[model samples]
Target: MKIKALLAASVAGVMFAGSVLAGTLDDVRARGKLNCIINTGLAGFAAPDDKGNWQGFDVDFCKAVAAAVLGDANKVSYTTATGKTRFTKLAAGEGEILSRNTTWTFSRDVDLAQTFIGVNYYDGQGFMVPKKLGVKSAKELDGASVCIQTGTTTELNLAEFFAGNNMKYNPVPIETNAEAQELYKAGRCDVYTTDASGLYATKMSFDNPEAHVVLPEIVSKEPLGPVVRHGDDQWADIVSWVLRAMMSAEEKGITSKNVKKLAAQDNKDKEINRLLGKDPLQGLSKLGLSADWAVNVISQVGNYAESFERNLYPLTIVRGMNALYKDGGLHYIPPIK
Candidate 1:
């Protein structure tokens, strides 16, 4: 009797999981809006603008997904999540896509039952200190009070880095980037540690950015990307390909200004034509996207390079590892065809 009951439960669970997977695209269409989860506030990544509108690199990625899925870039609702609450909110279904500047890790992908589609930014953990502190290298910061976001890979990385280096430090935990900024600015913490890009962003936000210097050492690899719940391959494809479309658009010299014209004409490059929906690419329909989905993404939200320059340039973030593969960086366009 017990064995029979267990078998029945297993079958029921599979059915439930199947439904959840199949229903994501339908749910987004029926609701007419994409729910995007993002960081609480990280300058140049996922922070609000002067007019109370969310605008940043991650924000542009979310908008691109909305454009691809809903045909309207503005048809997105944003939910801000701190380091501690991000996974819980995503698992609880508070959002359709987690477009936060979240690090892709093993435990997050497997143990948490979340799927990281692909990396949008390749980064490494780094440290920052005020010039007054006179810290040149990460190795110089012994016994420093570090302001770090709680419940993040940064925390574990911090501990491991310090332990490995035979250094001791005090931790100042905060929930959001905004809180960390305030604490660090108020001199509550002697150092700030996070993604190198984040360190640059944080440093740029200060009254005197030159007063703080990001350390020369980069500690851990942080491949940041968008995420979706597991068991949804179709939904995952839609999200993943949206990023791919943007990247390929840049590689093919297709910008927002010219995408519409290119889509209307016959292009010599078959991939460009296929990507712009001038020719059919099999399985776009299977992914529950329109033929012109890539068009919408590039036209409405701009390509990946445009988004990066518009958002991150202000922070002085150089396109080091985030640059295209052809440009001696890590980003590679998965062939659109």
Candidate 2:
């Protein structure tokens, strides 16, 4: 009966693993706060305000998930992680969700055992240089010293772009955006390379922001989004739909200013009613969230447009690829109903 014993032990191990995988929601609920991992300090994406409050495009998504699950957007605790430590912290369960400006890729999704919920920002790698440098294009930087963050897709993209152009340059590797900014400003590197959106954010933080100009060329696509650990289907769905709900709310004209009022009445739009919990939508109970979850998210954090305009607009970041689908952008979301 040795074979029988081995099969029994195997079944027991599977059950234990399933239980662990299924406990993310329960764990958050029990903890009474959602631990969200964010960037150390990437201005428009995730940075502390003068008053030490975390506010940005990525921070809002974490708050939205907190609102949807815990019924309070402010019930989230933030943990700062550098690019090199983000995935390791997530995989180790140090944080429930990683809302840093992380790019989604095949290896991160499959090999690392993590799930990227959806793309919050469509970005591309670009270069920024001082106007005094007189370099208008990235191609002109043949032998330039490029300041790039370590452990990012931008690093790989930079290498490939330079190699493809048959050029060589000195690499000034750094760990954080703030470090890169410091070194670039001190003339340690001739060029600063990162996502185009990030370039704007970095520029805005400078003393004389107008002195720097981002080049026109976008070298590689950077689909940035929120991430969670793999093997938790329920937690993944909850986070995924939290983002989708914000997009759907924007598509349906449900802004934070009017979400509560609209939720009180039965509108002609059945989808709106369903989203605001006037009518029941199936499968939400399985995710262990309330019927008014979408309402909480919309009312607290607002739609995707609101978050972007509030955080990125001040940095002069226009919604190029981040605009709605009907508005000729890539932010199309599936129906909430």
Candidate 3:
């Protein structure tokens, strides 16, 4: 009976692989566009621009993947979701990639059967309050009402932070950042809490951003990145490598401005040559990508730094921990070889 059970499990595994894992690439190629799930609205991350085009750091990552896969950065159809619905939408095949500011948690990574490709942004949870409250620190808010998005780590962190500090507070549960922003503006909550990046993004959307102050107490670490469903390792590798390629291009000083020139040259840097497809890079054929996939990604989406600076720099979000490792940031790109 044990042997029979083992055989049944093996057969199930094969069937699962055949059904779910296979054909992601083929489906994407046939569709002629990459379906990316993104936040409903977050400035500097995934919000639509004034011109109605999606453009931001996270949006650029989606574009990077589309460039690598579909050969056109603009070949992406975005589906927006709230924090509670992003996973469900991704699991239901509404999108191929979730490139929002999603945190990598054990439950979501392991239990939800999703793969966090890599950390694109290192962030921490913070509190934002109107300066009219005159609270200098988070500790001063003993009985403050905090507006937090439901179905996020921010909810638990807010509870713990208040308890740990021997304080009490009222919870203002919200479904989306937009809702939270509205509640915050209406003074329904004394403070708004979320990832510091999100706080800044939300603040930027306000009529008077300077009226709010982000408290210094960072409550939790948020390792935000792109996510793909499990079972499609090939698809996962392709998306993961798109991020690596952008970072590698930045590290090698290959900007969009220079990638075209560098790809056409025969420089002595073997990695540079290999990266831009000047020379044959092994394993491209297996991934069903052209030799110039990295070239397309960099030229179209720009390097990671370019994307960050272009989208996030306006928020005054200096690349404090988001910088490359050599430059004292947490970003460390793997080898292109």
RMSD of each: 5.5, 6.2, 6.3
TM-score of each: 0.93, 0.94, 0.93
* N/CA/C clash count, model 2: 0
TM-score computed on alpha carbons, candidate 2: 0.94
Report clash pairs, candidate 3. none
Which residue pairs does candidate 2 place in steric collision? Answer: none
In model 1, which regions exceed 4 Å deviation? 1-21
User: Please, what are the lDDT tens digits per residue for candidate 2 over residues 1-337?
Assistant: 9999999999976654542355899999999999999999988999999999999999999999999999999999999999999998887777899999899999999999999999999999999999998998889999999999887898899999999999999999999889899999999999999999999999999999999999999999999999999989899999999999999999999999999999999999999999999999988899899999999999999998999999999999999999999999999898876
Judged by lDDT against the true structure, how good is candidate 3?
0.92
34-94: candidate 3 lDDT, tens digit per residue: 8999988899998888899988899999999999998999999999999998897788787
lDDT (C-alpha, whole model) for all candidates: 0.90, 0.93, 0.92
Q: What is the number of backbone collisions in each predicted candidate, taken in the order shown?
A: 0, 0, 0
Residue range with the least summed lDDT across 10 consecutive positions in model 1: 13-22
